[model samples]
Target chain A: MAKKILIKKASGEKEIFSIIKLKKSMMSSGVASGVAKRVISQIRPKIKPGTTTAQIHRLAFDLLKSEDKSYAARYNLKKAIMRLGPDGFPFEKYFAALLEEQGYETKTNVIVRGKCISHEVDVIAEKYEKNIHAIIEAKFHSHGGGKTGSKDALYTYARFLDIKEAWNIKKNKGAKPREATLQSWLVTNTKVTGEVKIYCGCVGIKAIGWDYASEGDNLQELIENRGLYPITVLISLNHQQVRDLLHHNIVLCKQLINQDTLLSRLGFHGRQIQQLYQEINKLFGS
Target chain B: MAKKILIKKASGEKEIFSIIKLKKSMMSSGVASGVAKRVISQIRPKIKPGTTTAQIHRLAFDLLKSEDKSYAARYNLKKAIMRLGPDGFPFEKYFAALLEEQGYETKTNVIVRGKCISHEVDVIAEKYEKNIHAIIEAKFHSHGGGKTGSKDALYTYARFLDIKEAWNIKKNKGAKPREATLQSWLVTNTKVTGEVKIYCGCVGIKAIGWDYASEGDNLQELIENRGLYPITVLISLNHQQVRDLLHHNIVLCKQLINQDTLLSRLGFHGRQIQQLYQEINKLFGS
Candidate 1:
């Protein structure tokens, strides 16, 4: 009924401010509906043309923190996902785990054979019974300010086509199962450019970014849907602790909860552990 | 034969120190054969297994400079190529000029149409009589440290394929000449990896780095063969002067020499201008 506010994104692109998207994120953060509405009402008057999404986020975060600090931490999921990488290995491993949960046998950091040459694949995920096989390329840009675009999509597809040709040859030679359908996937922590989506679609590559919707949930939604919140999502865990936890391969809060002893090795004291458990329970458990 | 000395290249790869390569570079620098042989003999005792190419370059360069100052500038051709870029437009223009010397009608920074999207092509070179139409992709690294690899080859090929498909469609409709063969050309100021050469070969793309040979003289050899050395090759010019000269589209030393009035605009006084002309004459002519 009103003119939609244009908000500047971290990548310097303008996006329409959607109350529906905001409320969904708030609800996912465990904010009560009443509080989300109240926050939106407070934020409404401040909304003007060219107000940055970052400024809106800070305003929402401060408001959420005042209401519930733990909820505010949950709201900072996207930022925490960014903390999982500088080198991108942690993000790759975490995404591999997510695929593993979806009944795919996943391997991280694989050297896969291609038609042209050898390719260092990030994640090779296969579901034998369903005849679904995939090589997933994970691109993790730390801080999430950069947009992933067609170059990434194109190169990943280039690698995919090379490998796919080899796979087809292997299948004909009886090296691979005839029924296996090989697919290429590109996953990124950053938002996808429009060109990326178009290019990926044109090439029959399934691409997923934090905001790119291919056939299913984007990375953020997938995390929420699967309850596979990364240990980085815990605001109380500092950079060192998160690094140490990922070093032990305890990526998800779900995995860390099962291995309580691992938290001590990460320098979490008894009280801190109790608080983490409480936060984890609130975020994931009943 | 003595054990071939291992030298670390700028890309951190170990290479065999070739006397032939050194000699050829010296010959190109206008150094006499007797002097080149003497310089090599003097430098041989200093050569260690793990000596960097940078050190060897310095050794050879000092020897050449002692022999002739103007010749040293020509010997530093590769380094001059590096100075032609921070933004890369100068190198692109310089390269376009080199192509034009070969009788190719060239345009720089043209936005070309593709099937799926439009591409901002660096250089479009056409020789209608030969039915050779090309879109040249130029990659200019300010420092000659990074290695151009398969990713560049693959992505450049990808863009080429997209545009090539569109060109075919246009040709079918008689929009383009039926006999015109669309070629994709990638040129870079850095050394290309073996993988890039291999990949480009497989994809039918002509990739030429400073050293990656694709059936013709690479960028350095092409520049020398054409006598179209960049004005950056002039040691008398400072960084600001080079930038200003490039801004005015005076890319080649030959171009700059013809426009002597432009030298005064770049703050080179009468004596300095005469010296520059002498250096240019020595580098290009008898």
Candidate 2:
């Protein structure tokens, strides 16, 4: 059986969990068995560059269902899946979901618009008790370039908004004054340039960039540093420490996805869970 | 015609470049554009949970060639192409080539065996007036379900190495006492966990961490940041300023990639480039 612990955030929401709980859930929910099958049946050793966003989605969804494990969506998907196009990248949404499962009460895909222009953002993410934390754009690019897109892209777009001018109207209308939005992003598998830098600075927007190759590290930093949120936890944490925990979890997930022990104990119909088992098995190459 | 520049490095190697210069060489050298074309042509959208490292390599090579650009190895294939496996992830090797094209001296398929074990790292990188570096490993996994692999994975593998113990031995004496070896990485479509914070502490080996993502506003901060260069760069310039320059360059690269006029001007003839163009077009599709 898994152990459970309740965590209270500064905002007063409490979440209960434990590795054991995750392990138990993996076993009882048939997530392990299904994942194993998904690994075996769905994962392929060769994929192409122009693959569609939806294809990637189906792969993930199929793998999840195969394992009899839910996507932990109630936490991240509530916002991620709703805000993003089928092909657009879903890091923040998914990470937020992971946090949610860990008991963080947050809202993803909250829309925030320029006060006057009404330019809509894809996601306005907020942690509970925090004020409008970040304006996020999840870009799913086919290539991973490890840089932002266009030096002049933001400035050109800002020319259309004049968000500062819009903010003035809101202030005059007796609304709370707004600071310029923090860092924005051009998360793609392409690179960015210097001109984009000049434009973003002029408009008070910062770009947190990512490419396909660097997505893993970039996403982790965005959440931990909150590219927009930069609050270090009162307790100290480092990237490696967090990476270890994640690796541990991923390994365990992989194991559960591969193991037969969990499936036998869970009393799941062996045939029904075969698909999930294949997916999990494919992931670890078993 | 593309502008020409000298490949300058902290180490005094001299090389001049021009579009015509490379064009003349490609034509006269009788390089098989077909190999590059075939490599890049194979790049297409990856099916989720089914993609493999080898597939990602095929896509990147294809993408590189289609830009009318050659893999860094095109002009120097004997030393470059001979070393790689047909179906292995070639990220480290590819980037090393790019760095070489930009004027940095490089090595390929170099090995560093573990002091007390039978493990070996794939590439060892070095440049003038700087510490040696290592391109450890490249991981490809299905996107989603939160985290994928990262630099921490490399660092975890580091503790298992007997660098000091191995170096002290007569056989491994050439390894040398150095500031640090670069912990360079190439991750394709993976996500890392935010909990991975391991700077300035003794986790496994002291100060052994991977610099997988960019951190700090300037290059100086980035290098000092420990999170960005676990593996590359050979510079004595101001870190922040270098970072700023990189920031600017990245933005510019993004712009260049997105500009239809520019892409057209570049005269790349590969199908992979076309795929990139199509993907971008789809992002802004009406």
Candidate 3:
């Protein structure tokens, strides 16, 4: 216990376990700061060198579950989002829904004209009174750990500028076009690198990643607090069935419940549908 | 021969043979239009259903070889370019050299600042007196049969937009900045599609691909006419040796010939270097 314990990270690097960092991460997951401190103290006695971060994560997850289901769910936010896709499309649709919830009207896969080229934007968001529109490039890496880096940030910022140029040109052409500011955003399920953070900051790009809690509600908070668990989060729905639901553009659990008929349409039997709904309700109340 | 012949395209799509299309393609390879028509008429009897476009290309190539080595080299231009990369970096350097030849100072893999982010541009070229600078995205597909499509076009355009925004900001900040204009270009060593053509034209992107002979010398003409055959075009060099040379940024055969020391530096023995030079001299005069 007196010795500093070295724990393995997901990226295979080893670092000393720090109570401050662990507590801050838990707090981001909606656990009270006091609760995180208490949980870490309890695990302090069992701590050993060479323990993987995953094992530490497992212990934290179990303790949070024992505390409350919602606490556990919030702590599990990243893993839940990771279940969203092996591709970025479903994540784009889901992110558009998130933007919609923020009172911004959103469109997915909108082809915007640019000065030097046209761009098939992943998602475009607008809130007229705010006079701000956003061009978001949603990057979702599935079922594992990979941080969104500077490349995504640069490209996302680039797309936003192109669209903004076209927007300004159109405005100049119109007799009385409404004023709107264009914003660039990079949304991702995974964490972001320091380079991404610095570059995004330098360029005025609003980047949101899973554990990005620098300001406002990050992607994790938005999903966890809103209970916007994707259909893939339902234990009853297998990967194929989840894929089918996503294919039908029904990503959220709430969306799935309303379209029980889609379950049948996607070739699921009655018992499977019932179980899915039952799990959905248990995970997220009807 | 009495009926119209069906030719299979590289993409596995079937189409009817058109003498006009074939002749135009040949003319783009530096064959005179009149000679193209004559060659087509000469091969008219050999036209039959189910012949691949590749077979037709072979016939034309053989005829060109018999006529002149330069014509054969022009005809083999696309195939030569295809060997330039299994990666794009070498092509970036080669394209930068091309820009240099056009009286523009050039750099490869430059990080340009942007309004919203910084971009690692593939190639950048400037002619200050001309008051214009170009940002080029050099796309090279390895060994054959892929294309520069809309996705690439959109992203390349996006990167340019971001860099241009940054460029303008820097220009405005300078006490006596040159009144240079920024332009975006996408240069590929493969064929382009109708979508790429239309979108580029619509958005003012200067899209140049392998067969893009609408106006000024296209990629084929630039390489063949200038005798800038890539080091990959040397049959004497195997893939590993070519890759090693590419790693050292010796892409053009001219670059290779000038740096015979580089061949030995890459661990090639005396005879291998001699044979490579022999092939280079035969393919493109030293």
Question: What RMSD, rounded to one decimal, does every model reach?
Answer: 3.9, 24.4, 5.6
True contacts kept of 2: 0.00
lDDT of 2 by residue, B1-286 (tens): 5333454222244445333343444443233566444433344333223343333434543454454333322322222222222333343444444445445676645554444332334434456466544444433332222343223333333322333345446434464544554444333223344322221122221221122343322212222222122111211112343233333332111233444454344443456456544433322221
TM-score of 3: 0.74
How does each model score on lDDT?
0.84, 0.36, 0.76
Q: After aligning candidate 1 to the native by TM-score, how far in Å is the CA of B25 from where it should be?
A: 4.0
Instruction: Evaluate candidate 1 and give its CAPRI docking class based on DockQ.
Output: medium
Which candidate should be chosen as best, given lDDT against the real structure? 1
Tens-digit lDDT track of model 3 for B1-286: 5577898887788999998798878876668676677778777778788888888888887776666555555666677676666667878888888777778899999887777666778998888888768888888887455777766766676667767777777788883445677888889888887767876776667888987943477887787788777766565677888778777777777887756677778888988887766666766543
Docking level for model 2? incorrect
Global CA lDDT of candidate 3, please?
Answer: 0.76
10 residues in a row with least lDDT, candidate 1 chain B: B256-265
The sequence of per-residue lDDT tens digits that candidate 1 reaches over residues B47-74 is: 9999998899889888777877667788
Report chain A TM-scores, every model. 0.88, 0.37, 0.80
List clashing residue pairs in candidate 1. none
Fnat, one value per model: 0.39, 0.00, 0.36
For candidate 2, report its TM-score. 0.24
What value of lDDT does candidate 2 attain over all alpha carbons? 0.36
- Ordered by lDDT, highest first, the candidates read 1, 3, 2
lDDT, candidate 1, residue A192?
90
